[model samples]
Target: MPFLISPVLTPGALARTPQPTLPTGDGLLLRPWRAEDAPAVHAAFQDRLIHQWHVRSCDSVEEAAGWIAQWQQAWKDESQVQWAVVDEETDELLGRVALRQILLGDGVAEVAYWTVARSRGRGVAFRATTTLTHWAFEEIGFHRLELFHATANEASCRVAAKAGFTLEGTKRSALLHPDGWHDMHFHARVHGD
Candidate 1:
């Protein structure tokens, strides 16, 4: 059965990442999402900034539950890793961070995230993102991790920079936004970076 190409080229060939609480100093912890988090997640997505970039929404708690369910399945499929960014002291859900579009074969993946309005202006996204990048490159065996955001998303650009991602360039109309198709900037971090 070992005939064709290098085993490393096939994505997700390594064992799935075990769910663990990834901690960042100052009481932040990134852990797997829980069923009880549906309401909070729903509320977070209600922010215009979130739906504007994510191109997805949840109208009801039921739908939010489904969203959580879908991410859970993505993990089982080894196609994604999602975590709820929480404040360990108060146990409040601050945001979410995930590595999606995972190509284990190519040793690469894409990072995505959204934070609640309350979490905005904080370093939540940057810290959580940096933590995830390290895990992807060191633990998940990915050589590169890329982050794409709408050209108009200045906050994300800053986060990418602060997280050690260098701007690679723009992808013309690479993603569709609510107003119409929009250009995207691709920021990346290699293994040694």
Candidate 2:
């Protein structure tokens, strides 16, 4: 597995990011969550747009902090890795993208992501997903990267397609939403050209 270390954590915080060794892209960096980042992460997840599609509601900042702490521990355990995406030029937390569901026996993994509402139209998710997927394939040597999204999430579908994942098909009645069980699109990108 590859790791991410942000040059943003350095003194001055204004320089080219040293390549993450993992293929997390050139213009953006994905690094581990910090305790100081809790407030912003909480605020970003609070966007109704994000919660409706990505996760259940997290009602308060305290709840968000708890989630972040858990995420940190997960990374330490090598069970899952969630990244906080930040712009290299400005060091602002643009969003988050993660790779989970590590199936070591199958040599496969699943990718998930979200971009801050204010940053939606700017290709943040696409870049983050691309970077993460490239790292997963090249460094982790995973054979398949899977993605799932609610059928109503057209934006997510578009991002996955743009990242070169093929939509395998939909799984009927696969996910339980607030309304009811709903179909989900299954997409994947395999290693190699």
Candidate 3:
């Protein structure tokens, strides 16, 4: 069966090309995850905040490697894409930014990110997310992008706003964290916005 309206973006759009490395003005580069990143990823998971917000931890380097493998596969599947945000000069992992829950037909995805403890308060997440947002809208032709964060996460709320996402509304108990369900603040940016 076919619908009257055509798909917003054709399938295989992402799978057709390799993910590109994006650079930010703040001396950061968002690149594909590498095998060597497993140790950094595992170490990052040990951060209490990361573990609490993401609701998962890499117990060992092997498990972190598996996570990286899954992220790589997601790009080929056209279901999601993730980038390891690293220092431009040193190539040290600073954070991560991703567009997950991608819907090709709808031309939409959810933005997610996290920063290492040292990278916090330095605008790493904001810069990386802004770069990814531009790529998603201009390069890939996404119609809209959505971002959600636990309402209690004031820092994340700031990042969303800094990245040009408008606060839309709140979803009650939309996400489950280690402590309990969290009310999520919904933010979005459309093609023109």
Candidate 4:
């Protein structure tokens, strides 16, 4: 079964639901996305590598702001969970990890992420994914989390492995990349191991 984000949950409902803050080893923290984060989010997505891996290409700052607004409302609706990976000391944005395509009934959500090029290979994605998974299971009560990495992206595959997600298989011609239709590796983490 596929899980869709429950769009009907109200702010009060979300407020009553406990959300846990996750701390990363290198002075990074994962928490809910804020409207004020629009600027940083916009800057992070400008990288070509980020676009290739995450399938995000924003045309302008306004576009990023618009997306952030939607994410803010998503937090209120208790549907999709979006988090900003921030430096604990300076509170500077480092990247983002989000659980989208969420289906509450099926107990599943899709995890996607991007780390700024400068921050890549620093275990940022690994730590963030692990922390987010723990929060999703503990706070959101999801039974499964799914991650899809482009077959061409070895770094992402490594990140998934480090985060302890099982490589389930591949979806052939799953995504249309700039180069061509590409294979996608599916990884998953289920509740309670």
Q: Compute each candidate's TM-score over C-alphas.
A: 0.92, 0.83, 0.98, 0.87
Compared with the true structure, model 3 gives a TM-score of 0.98
Give lDDT: candidate 1, residue 81. 79
Kindly indicate the candidate among 2 and 3 with the higher lDDT: 3
lDDT of 2: 0.77
Compose the digit string of candidate 3's lDDT tens values, residues 1-193: 7799989999888989888899987799999999899999999889988977887877999999999999999999999999999999999999999999999999999999999998899999999999999999999999999999999999999999988999999999998888999999999999988
Every candidate's CA RMSD: 2.1, 8.4, 0.8, 4.2
Write down the TM-score for model 1: 0.92
Per-residue CA lDDT of candidate 1, range 75-192, in tens?
7787887999999898799999998888877788899988999989989999899888877777667888889999899999999999999999999999887789989999999999
lDDT of 2 by residue, 1-193 (tens): 5546422122212112322423355667787777777778778877888767864777777887888898877665555678889877676888888878865545677899988888889888898899888777775566788999998889999999999999999999898877778789999998983
What would you estimate as the lDDT of candidate 3?
0.94
- Shift of residue 50 alpha carbon in model 3, Å: 0.7
Please, what is the whole-model Cα lDDT of each candidate in the order they appear? 0.86, 0.77, 0.94, 0.80
Q: What's model 3's lDDT at 14?
A: 91
* Model 4 misplaced stretches (Cα beyond 4 Å): 1-15, 18-20
lDDT of 4 at 172: 98
Candidate 2, residue 178: CA error in Å?
2.2
Those runs of model 2 whose alpha carbons end farther than 4 Å from true positions after fitting are 1-26
Candidate 1, which ten residues in sequence have the lowest lDDT sum?
8-17
